[model samples]
Target: MTGATVRPVAIKLDDAMKARLKRLAEARQRTPHWLMREAITDYVEREEKREAFRQDALKAWEAYRSSGLHLSAAEADAWLEQLEQGHDIDPPPCHS
Candidate 1:
């Protein structure tokens, strides 16, 4: 955020929610504003990663459909197991 322009945005919360936020902020020794900002940032980052993963899955599915090439589940599992056992090896070749 260095040298980046920031603008203030306002949100309205119910009384009970505001009280809860205040208590949590006090317990954490941070301002309510900081807590809200952190929450929003964490939510956005998580959602972004989830969306990227979904897009990648869609792309992979499309590629598989177009080419009809893939490794069986067992083949993929074996490759993963090898890697988990500290073996450095290529993925199993894809096939119809």
Candidate 2:
């Protein structure tokens, strides 16, 4: 009802996987095509989030290596604990 026309996608699956998909769709009371669409949407969204997390970690690692600026684990944990307790706490400053 979004007024978006549905486009058709043709996929080829091995016989075993095809049978499994049919069983899952039947159990869910959905068509195999609907199940496939839902599965792809879920997978893409999950992978995109994972990719963003990986990129952020890489950037953090590079920054640390280049500047030697970081908070010790204990300091970081203390800051996090305070925040979790709803305390308005600033993060500990990074240092070499």
How many clashing pairs does model 1 include? 0
Clashing pairs in 1: none
Q: Model 1, poorest ten-residue lDDT window?
A: 1-10
Name the 10 consecutive residues with the lowest summed lDDT in model 2. Answer: 1-10
**How do the residues 34-94 of candidate 2 rate in per-residue lDDT, one tens digit apiece?**
8999899999999999999999999999999999999999999999999999999889899
TM-scores for the candidates: 0.96, 0.83
Q: CA shift at 92, candidate 1, in angstroms?
A: 0.9
Candidate 1 structure lDDT: 0.98
> Which tens-of-lDDT digit does each residue in 23-91 have in candidate 1?
999999999999999999999999999999999999999999999999998999999999999999999
Q: What is every candidate's alpha-carbon RMSD to the true fold?
A: 0.8, 2.1
